[model samples]
Target: MVRKKGVYGIAIVALICFLLIVFCTKEPDTVRISHNFQAIEFEDVDVIGEDISIDKIIDTQRLRLERKFDVFKFVTNKTFNKLSMLSGGQPLRTIIVTTWRSGSTFLGDVLNSLPGNYYHYEPLLHYGIMQIRGPPHADTAIKTLKNLLNCDYTDLENYLTFGMSHIYLFTHNKRLWTQCEAYPQYCWNATFLNEFCRLFPFQSMKVVRVRLRLIEELLSDKRLNTKVILLVRDPRGTLQSRRHRDWCPGEPDCDRPDLLCADMVSDYSAAIKFNKMYSRRFRTLRYEDLSLSPYKVVQDLFDWIGINVHPEIKEFLDTHTTVNVGGVSSTYRDSKNVPFHWKNDLNYTEIQSIEATCEEAMKLWGYVKTKGPKLRDFNPLTSYTIK
Candidate 1:
């Protein structure tokens, strides 16, 4: 009888240990559910919470869950949102349009670092695809656009129900803009443009920051808020950089008569003509200003758009300084030498041609000219004297 009793006691002890092990191994179901739901929310809208038949109670719970998730997402990704908050609900609609190698990538990286701003690097690709392909169907397009804009269709419809009144920054690669009209079949697809305009009837603002003769041709679209920034460098420096570092495939050959060096006389003639035509709306900032004191110029630009500078902006500027081909440094190693190294690579004739072509732009932007003739009334690009 004693032996049997001892054996029963041992059996009880073993059963308790097994139960404890099982409980420890199992993860909390609630935590698992929450994580899965969040992942689903980010990927697609249809993967939300389980549906409850009762309308009122289910709707309230779903709203609560969404709000909770939104708060979580914001906390996790506060950099962009911080900028949006600084704007007091009027988020920046910035478009960093530029010709190849004009330091737009650098500018974009800086803007992207700011909180609350949605920075799309080369968004023109998406725009082109949509325009050419049209939406898969009306429903799919509506859903995608709403997601892209981060707003509901109802909100967008209400905003554009009236006439065009809002400010939209439409930044594009200069190459894309140049090709849109001339090589219509190559880059022009009206489906996206037509739909976007029809859906959102707001004035489209463009950023033209390169020294190109094509600027005048761009003005045919009267509705464009064409702001030009004739970003220029010393002719010697420009050509050298173009030859060694910044050569883009499929660009016009610099040797061709029609395709003069970007800094040549023809380029300046085009810039001057464009500037005169859109004098009131045009603005220019030098490549030097961008390299040296980017924050000040960018701040002024933000102010122009009525966005008050955040006090924390100084902190961001102090920390981020390196400029690379990809724009911002993904790593913290210092890289200030990248921008100034183009001076060592150009030949004399190349330098002279660049200077000859870009003389007008150089004078306009207050660059000290080396070989080109000076303009009589060459106003500094930043000489926007407010009367």
Candidate 2:
């Protein structure tokens, strides 16, 4: 009996000590998710849970922004915005500025390969054949772009609908397309599109219509937090690829290498200027270099745009760059050999015309000018580096 009592007393003391120690030790007040650039964040929280915090953040952010945000206004009327990156409310916005047939579709897909992005394919498609040319159209261009970037589809209601020249636009956005396919009722409903767009942390668009000078104002507005990738291609290769398009011949804006080179000259000057001004935000990528080294170029591109190369982006690079060329508008290509494939399509006479017209760009952008040689099959007659 005495031994039993001693053992019980010892056990009780140990239990009490453990309880006191646990009570005295401080527990952390809050925890953080490892990554900060996630869908949403919390300013006040006792516990950190993604689902709970994200919903509260969304409601708070929407209410705060709704006060200053005008439904149908733009850069000319209302200034861009003040939301921080994905960390706060706004998603990162990037525009790929390139001419048609310059592997822009492929490059756009590279950005789209990031897990969650609201991909805008050729937003200027609504502008039709006569792209944004001058003052008459400039305001409209800026306004439209601002609205789209901000996920405000108020004015674009007509263009944002289904079946009438908007199929391609929705279909290109895999996530949106999937949801739309699943729920046809919400396919292009302005409300659905707006909400869907907000869910993403990145917005990517490719525009062949606007010039660098035109977008200077858009980039100036820090609130938009816009970045640009000027994707330039050798006119020789550009014109060759453009030949595949039946409509390009008659459109001066489309096929004429001379006209294209002139635009490039104007844009290239602006590129140099923008490089000095917005070194972190603006990038110039040559199609040849991208094709020659897709992995390295894309990795660098991701870093420049404030992201690491995502696994999906890596898989896209692997599968898309190495596969044989697909449909005319398809992103898949044997990227390594696509640069010089134009040589097989164009004869020396055609090459001379393209080269002569693009001489200044070729020289400035570093393309070795071929005088009278007929080395059509020789891998890219023009060097891919800048002089």
* TM-score of each candidate structure, all chains considered together: 0.48, 0.75
Query: lDDT tens string, model 2, 273-341?
Result: 888888889888888889988899988887777665656677777778777765677677888888776
* Steric clash pairs (candidate 1): 79-115, 80-115, 80-116, 81-116, 83-115, 131-192, 263-357, 263-358, 264-357, 265-357
What is the overall TM-score of model 2 with all chains considered together?
A: 0.75
| C-alpha root-mean-square deviation, each candidate | 12.8, 11.5
Model 2, C-alpha of 322: deviation from truth (Å): 1.5
Q: Over 4 Å off in model 2, which ranges? A: 1-88, 161-163, 376-387
lDDT for each candidate structure:
0.39, 0.71
User: Which tens-of-lDDT digit does each residue in 1-387 have in candidate 1?
Assistant: 999999999999999999999999997553111212101111112222333222332233334434433543422333332322222222234433344345555565454433333333432222221121122433443333333333222333332322122212222222122222222332223333322222211112222222244444334434333344454444444434445433333345422322333344444555566567766444455555666665778787555543445433444455555433232323221334434444334444554565566665455545554333333333223432111
Against the correct fold, how does model 1 do in TM-score?
A: 0.48
**Candidate 1 lowest-lDDT run of ten:** 35-44
Number of clashing pairs per prediction, in order: 10, 0
